[model samples]
Target: MTATIVVPTLGRPSLGRLLEALGPGLAKHRFELLIVDDRPGDRPPLALPPGIEATVLDGPARGPAAARNTGWRAARHEWIAFLDDDVLPDPDWADRLADDLAEAGEHVGGVQGVLRVPLPADRRPTDWERVTAGLADGAWITADMAYRRAALARCGGFDERLPRAFREDAELAFRVRREGWSLRRGRRRVTHPVRPEGRWVSVRTQRGNADDALLRHLYGPRWRQRLEIPPGRRHRHVAITAALVTAGAAALVAASGRRGWTAVAAGAGLAWAAGTAEFAAARIAPGPRDPSEVATMVATSAVIPPVATVHWLRGWLRRRAAEPLGSQPAGLPPAHRCPAGWAALSRPTASRSVPTRPFASRSAEGSR
Candidate 1:
């Protein structure tokens, strides 16, 4: 079976590095490369090496899920391998993938590869980078996943409603398992460099809570709690709000000539300071040079919980009515349209067993 490597990019020329890293493997396997550019009016530099056929597919700037679907649809191969823009694949990655697919047999619908990261030594990592680093070295099915074209077609690709990169891949894998297909892990590994991110990365990632709500709507409530996915610091939000309210009441009482106001303010200040300091200390390294960064981290800590809580609450409320989950997009080609009168896809039951864990790492060509 022919293989196609689909890379979804946001017009970052840095993505060329990912393609370059895969050159040896792609050339050896004679695999085609498809680059889907989601940016409008911007084209990625097309200076690809010989034997790698690159095509740029344009689609609405919905998100990575949409971009991946667009690229996979444009591919001509029976199997589609997905790589993130920030990953560097090993030289033998392609051959290992082919062998893994062959070993999986016909019922195997997908294969996930291992991801490794080498962190920088000089700089203390920001909280966001720390979270990202934790994701590396784990069995992740989303970043380096491969799927059969027919299986993807059967389940209607990724749910485009997932507006961000987080958890969308897991959601797709969950659906694939529900369909009674197996997803095995490959022995090949990819290196994911820790890119520099702004300090607000953790704060902004609170959007993931909203996405989690969407996943719950699609997969039911047990998935999150069972998977031990922490519901984004909602308890911290309640604590912050309580402290603020108590401080406000204390101020009003003091203005009315009451002695209790001092106690209230002291209590609130102590609670807020302790909470912030604890969060900052947990994330920051202790050193003379890190004091300023530590202070900034502490100051920002209080704001994160409330923002995360509000976003989660909003998502939960918006989806409380149990609206139809996956409706076919309008104006799709006749072949891409969902079957008429087909009942809406329901949440797959947790009792359903996944034939093979999608994220397990195995040997390539029977070699470690």
Candidate 2:
């Protein structure tokens, strides 16, 4: 069985490593490789290895969701397998992938490969390590997932409105299953190494709260239960933000000599402090708790609540009029015409080639 491997990339340095590791696995299978470059501006041309042949396509720089849609729709095979730019596929990945597809029943629409993240052995993991490790348990992460070409064509690829990598895969999985397709786990494995991050990595992740808000808007509050997602600390974040806001407002009122405002401000401040402390303790307890790690945890614990709350509200407001998954027509965005060079580029070549042709229309109704 042949499959198409689609990888969406921001042109990270790890792209070369992934390609190098992935090449050997494909030796035993008939697979096409498509790399969707999501970078907005011009850069150096991608350095292709000598033996591996890959087609390079331009992404709209919207996000991975848009890039992935650009990919599977352009594929020539029955199954489209997605791998992140950073993941290292096992040497037998393609063999296992073929077996996985061969065993899939007609009703099965998708297969998920196992993702193993490597952590530090000697020291306790940092907060970021723990967060990256969570991908191992994540549902339909697209870190290493394969979907039937027919299933993608039927369910509309992915919601481009989700501007981040977070939740888009699960959201699409929901739509796929809602369309009467079952998803199962596969034996193929990929190693996801924890990449280095800035000190504010945890803070940056709170932006996903906006997507969470979008999910809530699309699926209602019970979306988490339906998606089999565990209840998160969003409720606590909301309470903490409320307490902090109330404390500041009450303090200002107390300065104006309002009766009992000082007590109210004191009470609100105490609530915020207690909530922040508990959150920090929970995070710090499992981590290495080095001075820098503890400081990051404490500082971010204080900042995360208000940031998460604000993003959640922003998403809630932004998608207030959005329809749920199946309420509208869904499928890969339609194309007007293929670029002139597509036919020639689609053919396999002995030498390296990059196809710089636009495939799909940017304007599609209800794709969000």
The TM-score leader among the candidates is 2
The sequence of per-residue lDDT tens digits that candidate 2 reaches over residues 202-299 is: 88999999999889888877999877676899999999999999999999999998899999999999999999999999999999989999999999
Model 1 C-alpha RMSD to native: 9.9
Mark the regions of model 1 whose C-alpha exceeds 4 Å error after superposition.
Answer: 41-51, 121-126, 137-139, 225-232, 245-269, 285-289, 321-368
TM-score of each: 0.77, 0.89
For each candidate, what is the lDDT? 0.66, 0.83
Which consecutive 10 residues in model 1 have the weakest lDDT in total?
A: 359-368
lDDT of 1 by residue, 38-75 (tens): 66554333333334445655655688888788767666
Which candidate leads in lDDT? 2
User: The CA-based lDDT of model 2 is what?
Assistant: 0.83
Angstrom error of the Cα, residue 324, model 2: value is 2.6
Clash pairs of candidate 2? 156-331
